[model samples]
Target: MLKMFISGSIANNTIPDEVIKSVDVSMDKNYVILVGDAKGVDKNIQDLLKINNYSNVNIYHIGNKPRNLADKNWKQFKVIIDESNPKLFKDGKFTRSAQMIKDKRMVSEADFGLVIWQDVSTNRFGNVQVSKGSLNNIYNLLKMGKPVGLYFVPKPDEGIIKLTDLTYFENGVISNMVNVKTKQYYYEMKSEYEKVETQKKHDKKSQGEQLKFF
Candidate 1:
């Protein structure tokens, strides 16, 4: 049973239909879904899970007090504050830092990440810019050798996302070409992931040398 961490940007109100179908298929395979109690995407996903009666879903919230508790029955993982860390606690109470700790732990515990993403220079939800944080989690999951099934929805009329999807290691093998639009998982792109990783390492090294020369 694959434990899938399902997360996305709060700025997204229009989630793609195909993405919903993909979640349906994943649930059919009994993949346990771990989601957070956030306002936009997370809340929407939970609404669908309730409508479909997906009982295997688990939720993580900032602290013992969840901002979104749509279901009272589902098990909630309270990522309590690191009391020993003064930065995380103010006046002996949990602070906003607990949210980030919860986010990191979600990625670490998952076997796979089913993420819905859209690229933008700045995505503001109310007043918070969230896309970069989601991007960071995706990269961390890739670095951990976990498969991230990314369902990317480009902004209307936009060409493509700027941040290229980093591919994971795949055994050299060939198969029929499917998923032409490339809206599905990127690893299906004919062994393209490893090549991207190689380029990224080279780029990093180049930057380091340039910095050293300064």
Candidate 2:
């Protein structure tokens, strides 16, 4: 059975109908859904799974127990963190590093990923900023040679649209047409984006040298 890793931004408390429809399609296909236990998209997805009475689901977490599980009967894949890593623990609580460990495991186990993204702000570079965790999940899956389908929630009132559905890209590089192909997994986008950024830096350095010689 195909294993699908699904994650989204914590900022988006509600899942758009379009995204839900896609999940339903996955369910119809009997794909094993792999999800996290956090609130927002994770919890929403879990609730959907429970409503459908779907049992082929695995909840990934970083502790003896998950923070939240919509269906208690669903299997839990506990990610044990090393006690020796100080960064893994903070103030008697598991840190983001610990959560990332769980995320990485999900990326490794799944054949592909689905990300629900909402732009939080725009950076100084005119690039749209989104939840790091969601982006990390996408990047990790892409790096692992697994494609990811991205759905963008432009506004709370407006439902999600496939990233390709948008008229313009968000990041100017990673989210562009060439990097993330239409209706396909994000194949080699990370490496390609990096190459473009590197070239930009090289061009700037060469221009600086030319100015010095003048």
Candidate 3:
């Protein structure tokens, strides 16, 4: 079975309950591992899953500081984690680099990844952009041959781009582009990945059968 990894900025309300529902229906029986920075939409997604009785999902909180953690109103977050047996990597007390290392570890362990992020307009880290780290992580995962599905929510004022107007790529190179809406494009990309994965499994099974005869 394919394992899915979900990543996004919880501080921004980009991840919606609808997105979670869509993923649940699309994934069917696949295991979902959610990795997030412990903030706004991240908590929202978790809460929605709990309300919907999704007991098999695993959530990892990668926040390193109290400020980065979920707020007190969401104290149930811990209870949910405990009940779900989700892994907690609370290195927030450590350095930013440490948190980043944990993030990479989670990404490496996942078969596929979904990233939701918005491009930063200002230089928050001197000359560096805010979402730069996230972008780099996504790029690295693609370079390692992991299928990545990216969902970008354009700024509210910016008109939504049709799926046909967008381009997607792996490892900084354009793999394909579509003129449809974002969600439709996601479905198409996911279907293609599933087809490829199915072929890989078949090939592996064939190899195993050949070895058994030897």
Candidate 4:
């Protein structure tokens, strides 16, 4: 069984549905964990999960008042809080700082971490700042030998950009790729190379075409 924890700026909605779809198709059984915040409980993710038959998904909303607790979408799993964090509940909702803290805690508890965020120079509501905090937590997880997968969705795009564009680790250094288009091209070429190699191993060519490579 493979356990994955999801944390990101909920407003982005970049990776949740795509992550879940990937997990469903993978060889391992998945336990999808979500750190719920005010913006995390969107209809897109809920409907996608229900339609895809994700029976092993679990969500942990770190708020005290619990706004979407009784919703049918959440009825599939058990929702719990850390219980030790007393500052989470305030003014009938969870504070932004508390939500970020909870996101870190959830990242620490999983086997692997997945983050979805955007790269914007200016954040109007300051919510995008949480992505940096979440990325820092993910960097720590990578230090502990955990594989942290990151996906970024650029503004005005509906699909998830490649993970390699937003994540990398080398020579004890971690960084995010700044050029999205270039990173995507790198991955695409790499994949094509792998496919050619696999085909070559099983291909038996005729004598006339022996000098030519596929």
Candidate 5:
């Protein structure tokens, strides 16, 4: 069975109509859904599933229990944390690493992913002008050569722009939609991806050159 990972910015509390429609199609196909237990999109999606009485869902969390599991009968996949692990704690909080671990697990297990992102403002990185968690979700999915369906929510109450499905190509550029509304921010993210890919290529070339000297 196909597994679909659904994630979104915690800033949005309601799911858009198009996103819900896509979820409906997934349900019709009896796909196993992998969702988080965060507020905003996660909680809203759970509510939708609960209303539809859908049970083919797995709620992923960080600790022994989920923060928000709408369906008690649904399955749970908890990523147990080690408080003693220094990497798991940032600024005296485990929230960032815990969520990353959970999201990574979801991305690894899913065949494809759908991300609902809100473009409010740029983060410290100034690469993607969206929620960090949602941006990471998209990047992780793409880097793993998994397809992603992105719903870009623009600021000032603009409607959602459903970007074409994207799959990373080794020698090709990152794929993105061309809209005057989102073009600038999209290219900003694309530039960052290019930098990473370039670094990887340079590192490999350096390794090969060293082998020649050996």
Candidate 6:
């Protein structure tokens, strides 16, 4: 079964028709989804599942209470604060570390990520542009050798979703098993499969240098 983590832009609440159809297909295939209790795409995802009566869903929340308590029947996992980062209280105000902790946990266990994103950032980080919080999970999945299906939210309220990588969904990636990891690795890679190749070359070069030193 495909286990997907759904995330999206916090700025947009719109849902495209293509996204709805993809969720339909995922539900039909008995996919289990993990979503946060935040607004934006998370809320949209909850709407889709609840309206369709898809019971195989889990909602992740931060702190003692969830930000959105729309689905009471949905099982929720409260994220424990990470002591290393230490974001419990700042100036008597709650920080967003709780959500980040939950996001990390979600990325660690998810088989694949289905996200709605729009590249609104003009500043480029090397080859890639800065992305939304949803892309954080997507990048983590890719770094861990997991696949992701991205639906880019269009401008001007066009009700369509487009995949950044056409060959991603075509490949049989959802059938793979998910690895259990305690931490998530968020790094810049070449591309989906290109990153694998790049990593292989880097490892080989490192091994060669080590042999010469020995």
- Identify the candidate with maximal lDDT: 5
Q: Could you estimate the TM-score for every candidate?
A: 0.65, 0.71, 0.52, 0.54, 0.71, 0.65
Q: Name the regions of candidate 2 deviating beyond 4 angstroms.
A: 121-130, 155-214
- Which ten-residue region of model 6 has the weakest summed lDDT? 177-186
Give the clashing residue pairs of candidate 5, or none. none
lDDT of 6 by residue, 169-214 (tens): 2232122211111111112322444777889999999999999977
What's the distance in Å from true for residue 162, model 6?
A: 9.3
lDDT of 2 by residue, 101-157 (tens): 899999999998888875354557986554667766867776567877777665434
Over 4 Å off, model 4: 14-21, 26-28, 40-43, 65-93, 121-130, 155-214
Q: Which lDDT tens digits does candidate 5 get at residues 1-214?
A: 9999999988788888888988999999999999999999999999999999999999999866898999899999888878788888666667676788889999999998988877454456775443667766777787777887777665323343333334332122223322333445555766887899999999999999999986
Residue-level lDDT tens digits of model 1 in 1-214: 7788888777677656766877899789988888898877788888888888888888997666677867777778887667788778778666546666787888898987866665332434444233544555676676777767666555323221222234322211001221222223333332465688889999999999999977
Higher lDDT: candidate 2 or 3? Answer: 2
Clashes of 4: 0
Candidate 2 has a TM-score of: 0.71
Can you write out model 3's per-residue Cα lDDT over 1-214, one digit (the tens) per residue?
5656666654356454445655677446756545444565455656555565655455554332333423232222111122222233233243444445556766777777766655443344555234534554565566567776666544323222212112345212223222223234344555665798899999999999999988
lDDT of 3: 0.51
Query: How many clashes does the backbone of model 5 have?
Result: 0
List per-prediction Cα lDDT, in the order shown. 0.66, 0.75, 0.51, 0.50, 0.77, 0.66
RMSD of each: 10.6, 10.3, 11.1, 15.9, 5.8, 9.5
The lDDT of model 1 is 0.66
Q: Select the stronger candidate by TM-score from 3 and 5.
A: 5
What is the clash count for each candidate, in the order shown?
1, 0, 9, 0, 0, 0
- Rank order (by TM-score, best first): 5, 2, 6, 1, 4, 3
Candidate 2's C-alpha lDDT? 0.75
